[model samples]
Target: MGNGDNCNPNWKDASFSYYKYVPSLAAAGIFTGFFFLAFAGHSFRMIKARAWFLIEVLGFAGRAVSANQEPGCWTQPPYLVQTLFILLAPALFAASVYMTLGRIIEVVDGEKYAIIKRRWLTKIFVCGDIVCFLLLGGGGGMLASAKTNKSAFDLGNNIIIGGLVLQLLWFGLFVVITLLFHRRMMLSPTARSYQPDIKWRSYLHALYVASALIIVRNIFRLIEYCQGSNGYLMTTEVFVYCLDALPMFLVVAWFLWKYPGEISGLLRRKELYDGSMHEI
Candidate 1:
């Protein structure tokens, strides 16, 4: 129920954090985009690919904990729904990871691998994603608990931090592997033609925007965790929502929207592996 002597003037605010509302709103926005894809992108094979991320919309959730005991309990509904979302988020995230890898393989490897090997890689990636997701989900669910007792709250905070660390590790590995594969393909003469298929430069802009949103959101979350000793996350719910949540969701939606054309073309002709910038 106190400000807890924030170290910096910037941390002076004692208002409740926007933990609950922001995330819930972002989830809704993501779901709306998913619904659009399900209906509009239905005919395209990439629809299945997008399905992986669409399902992820349900994963956005958080709790209304008074970090280090700030003020009143959450004015919203019970924390149960947020719990479910956090627990389920890892699974959805894993699905997206698998989808991303699968799409990349289709673009880079093309007909190089036999059916068995291709299928094997897909399964292996998916399995790895699943395992990682489960680890994240279990820990993430604990994060949404908002334990009131000081000891319990601190424990929950630690769980969240640990989960974030694990997520960064796993995601970093995937990003590295994917980028290397993309680079190798683009450089190879055979795969050069596929460059046009990638349309990466076109997609890169959207990716940057979406990434900025997600990265900022995650960084903000990390800041909350760093305030370990008498932390105060949801300071001024409105500020948190405006600054971190809505922007992230909107960027994500736009990113997804950019894919329908490229994905549809790739699925129709399987030409993602057959084009390049010949003159450049």
Candidate 2:
């Protein structure tokens, strides 16, 4: 259509009106950080036990980015702190994930989870996560560069599909594996301390919610990508806000405070949560 405008692809089309709502958005970021902190913190035990913790953390970190919205909303005071929370979120989520998986493999022995122990699976996971991280990072960079050059949007929009697909695939596989584990456990009665399929499904449901939010926001990139190369996707500020910023924050907090660890000691008992065949 018209010539591309200069702005970061990250903020989408957030403009002067975006400024009007900056305070409100920043406030929401504060609440989101606190709410997620509990999820992130309380998940420590599960993180320790599971090999896929990094994937979970990155999923949440992406949500935290949604919470940040834009710098216009976080110019000063509490907003700055909130902004820091938003900015630092993805990295922390990544670190937590890395640490969680590494800890599980190291402490319990990687062989414990045969599925995870597969060299092929590990390679696939590592590659997929790297791609997913790069895609999200590219989006963030484009958003930042949007403050300067208009062309960076091209790279940002292009990388998203590959990343989203890989991320979603990994998450789907994760849900399936968890579901299978639950089904097996259900067939046996010895798993008294194990987290029932309910709790496992509940956690998976929460993770899916987070992934779905990011997936929705990322879809804007695809729309922009399809508009013809070198097209500016951020120009559609209305749709971006409605689809990406607004709805992306609608993650359910109900399960955060009441999960396997807090509600049941399943996360606390590593072997119990391991498999249906027997406790690890």
Candidate 3:
């Protein structure tokens, strides 16, 4: 009976062991993302289009490890890196979403389905994404590294909120355009001609779900950062897991499961015959 306790580790010790292994687990996740990136590049040859998604996945993996290692290590360089990776990573996912949507528009023929010219979709949304990334990255770095009083931290948090708000605005516009385009197509004479095949339609639905998931996640993040470090959202791990981590994981998993490479391959094939379908 006395040796029973020694037969197995206590709960606390088991937890510590799990915690200690988290960084290695996170590294494995990052490696998985890199492997997927290479897979997409090798299989589809559309590496340029898939780059943002890979970045986002790797970023999320990095953020997860950082969070586990330093639950609340503010004022530390690791904190800054963690915040930057998590904060900026989603913006990259959004960029990938935008690129995918734009390319879809091109695939369907811009004249009937898209409002903006196909050529302009990537240019506009990606440029906006770049701006958001800079703002969030800069702001998160400052906030995490701030050793000063509350005001300095608040300043950094505010800047992050600003960037997030800007992203929401940009995404809102994109959604509006997408809806309007869909509506326009539904009402047009060429509606029947524009309907995608079953596989393509499935891809479109996947994108829609992915976009909605990301937008919801971003909203949570915007609120979390706006609350500052001492805020309820920041102090609570549950909220972070449910709101931030869950949504992103769902979105990324959905897309990865769908594998955009298949869609891109179709687009490439179509582009050979259709003058309107631009090269991916």
Q: For each of the candidates, give the backbone clash count.
A: 7, 5, 0
Please report how far candidate 3 places residue 209 from its true position, in Å: 1.0
Runs of candidate 1 exceeding 4 Å displacement: 1-50, 53-77, 83-94, 110-132, 143-146, 189-192, 195-212, 229-232, 242-244, 260-280
lDDT of 3 by residue, 223-269 (tens): 87776555576655567556766677677667767755455755776
Candidate 1's TM-score reads 0.58
lDDT tens per residue, model 1, 63-151: 32223223333322324444445334444534444454555455545434223245565676567656645544555445444443555
Q: lDDT per residue, candidate 2, 32-134, as tens digits?
A: 5644564565467565444212222233344334345453333222322322233223333332322333222322333334355434444555566666776
Candidate RMSDs in order: 9.1, 9.1, 8.4
For this target, which candidate reaches the highest TM-score against the unseen true structure?
3
Against the true structure, what is each candidate's TM-score?
0.58, 0.48, 0.73
**Clashes (candidate 3):** 0
**lDDT to native, each model:** 0.47, 0.42, 0.63
